[model samples]
Target: MSLIDELVALHGVFAAGEYSYRGDRFSYKGHVSEEHARMASIMCRATSMGVHMQADIMAGSYPECGVAPAGGWVVRGPQFTVCVMANVFCFLDNQASLNAVMSILRTRLADASSDLI
Candidate 1:
């Protein structure tokens, strides 16, 4: 299914560039930033190239709320940006089910960010 179709299946509220999964909301503002869109876009392209998987904008922060950022949540499946500044880039991992692949993604992102240092 297409991203839009996959997104609708989640019963989320969709808008110009945002979506909410459950009570935990995600917007194209604050932490998520445009990075989410960028990531989703990458996932979409990869999926199109035989990377069977799911993609969404994951939540990043909520310190005062003391919520596990891993419960990071998601936006709709339509692959859209959240904001520009990440505040902090958090992700809800796939429960160690894909540890090997996840490690690489983390390393790449970290290495990519070295330019910012």
Candidate 2:
């Protein structure tokens, strides 16, 4: 199955896509509108940048930084949750299931050799 298709098949995934770091849509699958996907993409990119910046600051303080910054994040709201990677995002309604869902997505995307990170 296709990457987006596999992502959408996850238990709580309602929308999934491949988008640029600047929020331009390359492709998408599932029920989300183009506008929503782009919005999520933009948010993800911003958050990712913030995370890396923080990591950089922390690294500067340490003589030997062993851990790197997170490449992705999950944004949880009352209504939905968004999972974002370097070039992909997925929407889910159940925050309680986030860990499992992300694990599945990560494994699937890795196996498929897609640029999800």
Candidate 3:
């Protein structure tokens, strides 16, 4: 099965999708709307950019400045938690299932990045 399929197969995952850095959704599965997925990607990218900018400004001078890097982000609500990493987003209901889902997405993102090198 595809990665998106695998993502939705995970326990507690209700929505999943792949989006572009420009906030355009390529594909999505589950109950999430394309608009929501696109917005999530844009928000995460913006946050990541801000973090990188701050890190660059403090680079060299502060050794610990870049220690905490922004990558993926998780926003938890009362019934669901949204995870945004790179261009992938997943909505999960159980916090306990986050670790497994995150691991899968991290590996997928890493593999995709390596292809660009």
Each candidate structure's count of clashing pairs: 3, 0, 0
Prediction RMSDs, each to the true structure: 15.8, 3.6, 3.6
lDDT of 1 by residue, 1-117 (tens): 432232222322121122322213433322334766445434433332221111111223333443322212222223442111111222222332233323433443343321111
**CA-lDDT, candidates in order:** 0.28, 0.70, 0.69
> Candidate 3 lDDT, tens digit per residue, 46-114?
665565566556765776764434446677888888786666778889654888998988887764541
Which window of 10 residues has the lowest lDDT sum in candidate 1? 81-90
Scored by TM-score, the top model is 2
Candidate 3: residue 15 lDDT (0-100):
80
Residue-level lDDT of model 2, residues 1-117, one tens digit each, is: 876787788777888887665454557787878777667667776776787677667778983885344456678888898887656778888743788667866776554322323
Q: Give residue 104's error in model 2 in angstroms.
A: 2.8
Ten residues in a row with the worst lDDT in model 2? Answer: 108-117
Off by over 4 Å in 1: 1-32, 51-117
Clashing pairs in 3: none
In the predicted model 2, the residue pairs found to clash are: none
Which segments of candidate 3 are over 4 A away from where they belong? 35-48, 51-69, 112-117
